[model samples]
Target: MSIELLTLCLILSVFLVFVTGLPVAFSLGSVSMLFTIFLWGPHSLQLITHAALGSMTSFMLVAIPLFILMGNILERSGLAETLFKMVYLWMGPVKGGLAIGTVVICTAMAAMVGVIGAGIVTMGVIALPSMLRRGYNKELAMGAIMAGGALGALIPPSVAMILYSSLGKLSIGKMFLGGIIPGLILSFLYMAFIWIKCYLNPSAGPALSSEETVTWRQKFAALRDSILPMALIVLVLGSIFIGAATPTEASAVGAFGAFLTTVFYRKFSWRMLKEACFRTLKLFSMVMWILIGASCFSRFYMAMGAADLVKGLVTGSGINPWLIIIGMQISLIVLGMLMEDYAIIMIAAPIYIPIVTALGFDPLWFGILFIINMQIAVLTPPYGFALFYMKGLSNEITMAQLYRSIIPFVPLQAVGLVLVMIFPKIALWLPGLMFE
Candidate 1:
């Protein structure tokens, strides 16, 4: 069969399996196995073994589970609640203070833990109810939590960025640094929208009543509780920025610091530690299996000459490179609706990275831009992980309402994505300043 025909068959088969509700890891692995046996004979099954082994043995990937453990530990230890309380108390006097404070707390959480699940669930459980009880608009309140929770994917220590960096052969440290400015930009944009919207429409987020106010002494007490946790964030991120540690080493320090913070808060127990370890293993296992499956699929994809076919078409099209980049971003948004970030990165990065490099664009910049799109994908309707997480947390909120809430934040995310694209320096500048 022709290479094009084989590629079409493989892609269609994979899509059909996914549509049938087979797990992503199994779908990719099974499809790759069938193709390998048919095309390369049964003796060639060792290719799958080698690919899985190689991906699992990657040294940088060690950071993923450790960072996950760190996030899980802090989460179980009540760090999110404490941070929310601190920010809410401080910002409560301002218009739309609760919403603004939620965003700020999410940003801090992102700096500490680079996954969205813990932050979203924590904030959803804690801040969402508070906002609702205080006469805040449900859509505005939900939007802030979902959007802010999604920030963890864009911020440093991000496991998603780690996977992309490792696969794309970009520097993890540089990718981590590149994400900072853009993440903060998007975060600030969310805060700005909340402030302005509430300012214009007082009914959306009213200022707290005098009876709800905390004395200056009470505010100081709140600040005191948060100091150690804030310092933990600085210790982890600061160590990476100052050249004191590699990302993997920094992850270890983060995990240890999170445990110590729990001890300080007196929230530590044997059960808490066991739960953190168990959750880490579950999440880690899922991520690694997908990585192994995607590796097998990509190996078969190359064997089938799909990468070459794409290179030829892209290089021969004579189209503007920028247009191709835009097209790639659009495809990511569409595919993101159907797939998780890891699956999307695994399938697309191998095909797209070479094209990006061929066009003389910086891969690191494109990686940051891609991460921003993933943030938006998580909040989008019908299949967004964040939207489902919101619904699961609050039975009172309908799926339609959750979808409606995220609509406004979508464009704000795009604006951030465009800014990074138009001025690559926004992503590159911090990394360059630190490393170059």
Candidate 2:
């Protein structure tokens, strides 16, 4: 069969299997294995082994599990809760104060943890109850938690960016730096959206009553609790941004800092350590397996010359380069609804990256745009991981409520995506300044 026809069949087969409810890793692997054996014989099996080994052994990829472990440890510790409390006190008196505070706390957690689950679950458990008790709207409160937590994917030190850089063969440092401005912008947009919504309808995110206001003394006490936690962020991200440490080294620092925070806060124990390690293993293993499957699938697809087909199809089309880029973004959003972000990246990056580069766009900038779409993906309904994470945390929240909560934030994420696409410098500026 022609490679193009084979590629089409492979795509359909994978999607069909996925529709049958198979796991993403197995869907990608089984299809790739069947095709490789059919096309190239048993000798092609070695490609899968090599891809697994190569993907699992990368030193750069080690940062993923380390950062994950750091986040897990911090999650089990009381540090994130304390950090949220700190922000809650400082912002609690203002309009929509708790939701605004949740964004600040999630942003701070994002800088430290680099994963969404930490912030989402942490705030869901802590802030969600408080917001509900304070008479805030359920959908608005839940929406703020999920949306803010999703920031971890866009912010620096993101595991999503790490995987993207590893697959794209781009600079991990540059990708991390590139995400900063856009991350801050999206965060600001989320906070601004909350303020506007609450301002228009005061019932949605009501400010604390005079009786519930925190005293200045309490605020100072909360600030004191926050100083050390803030220092850890500075120690880790600051080290990377200032060229004092590599990403891998910075991950080590983050993990160690998390450990110290647990111990310093008297939240440490053998059980906590054990739980953190076990959770880390679970999360890290899932990510690695996905990576292995994607690597193998991409290998076989390339061996079948599908990448060239995609390049030819896109480049040969009479479409403008800008339209092609827009089309690619739209496809990502569609695929994102049904697939995990990493799986989508694995399947699409190889095909799209070359097309993007051929169109004269910077890969690092495109990487940031892809990450922003991922931010949207995890908040989109049906299969959004962030939505599930929030619902899992609170029995009070139903799936329908969770879906309704994230609706407004979805468009806000798209706004951020479009801004970065149009003004590449929003992503590139910080990277250029820091790396130069």
Candidate 3:
């Protein structure tokens, strides 16, 4: 069969299986196995074992479970509540202050945890009720929490970055550093959007009533509670930045520090520890399976000459490389609506990274762009993971409302992606300064 026919069949089969509602990992693995048997006979099925083993033994992947454990512990540790209280005390008096504070706390939590679900669910539970009770616009309140929480995907110590870097053979430390500015810029844009929206329509996000306002002493007390998490964020990311530890070693530090945090907060218990460990295991297992399945699928697809075919097509077409890059981003956004970010990374990274590098663009910059697009993906409609996460937080929110809530923020994310694309320096400068 022609390479194009093989590629078409592979993609269609995966989508057909996905429509049957099997898990992504199983769908990918099953399709790849069938294809291997058909094209190269059953003997070639041994390649699947090798791909699974390779994914299992990757040293960098060790960071994933550790990071997830840290995030789970911190989620139950009352750290997010304390950080929200601190932000509320300081920003609650201003128009749209609560929403703005949600974004800020999300940014801080992103630094501390570096996982999207933890931030979204924690803030949705902690901040959403407060915003509604204060009469904040439903869309504004929901959008803020979702957009801000997604920051975990871009901020330092991100699990997605770790996975992408591991797959692409990029520097994990440089990827972490590269994300800092873009994450902050996106955070800032979210806050600015809230402020401006409330400014134009004061009733949309009114300031806290006089009875709910706190004194300076209480505000300062709330501020004190944030110091520990801030310090932990510093210790983890700082260790990686200064070469004191690799990302894996830093993840261990983060997990330990997160334990100490719960102890210091008096929230630690054997139950909490067991729960965190169990949750970590489940999340890690899901990631590993997807990695293994994707590894096999990509390995077979490449063996069919898909990568070379794609490279030849793009290079031979004579299209502006920038336009091709934009087209790739658009296709990824469409994929995001239908697929999980992990699946997208697994399937697309191998094909896309080589093409971008061959075009003389830095793969590191493209990786950041890819992640930002995934961040937007989680907020998109129909099948967005963030939308589903938000829905699970409360039954009062319909899927339609959840979809509308993200309309404003998705554009903001797209704008952020474009900014990084236009000025590569935004993503590249920090990594260059630190790693070069």
Candidate 4:
């Protein structure tokens, strides 16, 4: 078969695997292996071996494990719980305060962990029950959880930034810096919306009773608990943007700092450390496998002139670049409903990255944009993972209710997405200043 035809077949096979519920790593690896043998005869096996080694061996990819380790460590160390508590003590009593607090916590967690599941699942487990228990509107509570959790991808030190850096051959430091402002803007927008919604309806998110409110002294005391975690976030992100450390190096610093913080708080037991290490290895392996598959897959596409085909398709078409970007976001929103966000990224990024770059946009800018869309996707109705994660968190909250829940947050997310697009500066400014 022709290479293009073979690639087409490989793509279909991978899609079938996804539909059949196989793991993404297995789906990609199995299909790629099958097609490699078919296309290159017996020699195809050599390509997989080479690609696997190359993918794992690359220095840029080393950030994956360390970042994963960082996420796992923070998750195990009750970072989310502490953050939620710290924010909740103040925000929780106000109308929509819990919801806003959830977003705040998610934003901070995203900077710390950079993993979607870590943020969503962690918050869902810790915050969902409290929000629901307090008579917060189900949709409001669930939407906030789903949307907030997904913000980790757009923010600095995010796994998406690391992956983007590796794939685009851009500076991880620059990508990290690029994501900082955009992430914060979107986060602020989401929280601001939640606050307003709570203020207007008071029904959407009722304030806590007088007894629920913490005193000024109590709030101040609570802020003290936040100093270590906040310091770690600043140290990791600040070091990167300031050019003192690469993302990998920052990840190391973050991990060590997280460990010490956990140890000082007496939360760092050997069991927790061992499990964190194991989970990190497992998550890291999953991402690396897809990266390897993608790297190998790109070889085929490059050989088939896929990049050229994409360039011609985009440039030759009469469509505007901004429209094309919106279209990509729409497609990601749809795909997010059907595919896992990570898988969606793996499948679409290679094709989309070239197209976006060819349109004269910065890859780091596009990376932040892409991640914001993914954040929306994770909350979008029907198949958003965050919705499902929240559904599992609260039995009283049904799937239909969960789907209904994100109505307000979705528009808020769309607002954030549009704002970032209109002022690419939100995504680009920090990276520019950092590099300059």
Tell me the spans in candidate 3 whose CA falls farther than 4 Å from its real position: none
Q: TM-score per candidate, in order? A: 0.98, 0.97, 0.98, 0.92
Q: Write one digit per residue (lDDT tens) for candidate 1, span 184-203.
A: 99999999999999999988
The C-alpha stretches of model 1 lying farther than 4 A from their native spots are none
lDDT of 2: 0.88
Per-residue lDDT tens digits of candidate 2, residues 46-113? 98888878988999998988888888888888787888788888988888989999998899889877
Task: Give the winner by lDDT: 1 or 3.
Answer: 3
Better lDDT candidate (3, 4) = 3
Better of 3 and 4 by TM-score: 3
Model 3: C-alpha RMSD to truth? 1.1
Q: Whole-model lDDT, candidate 3?
A: 0.92
Model 2 has a clash total of 0
Off by over 4 Å in 2: none
Q: Candidate 1, clashing residue pairs?
A: none
RMSD of 2: 1.3
- Tens-digit lDDT string for candidate 3 (1-436): 8988889999999999999999998999999999999999999998887888888999999998988888889888778899999999999999999999999999998987778888999999999999999999999999999999999999988989998998899999999999999999999999999999999999989999998859999998999988998899999999999889999999999999999999998989998899889888888888899999999988888888877898888789999999989999999999999998999999899889988987889999999999999998899866789998999988899987888889889999999999999999999999888877
lDDT of each: 0.91, 0.88, 0.92, 0.79
Pitting candidate 1 against candidate 4, the one with the higher TM-score is 1
Clashing pairs in 3: none
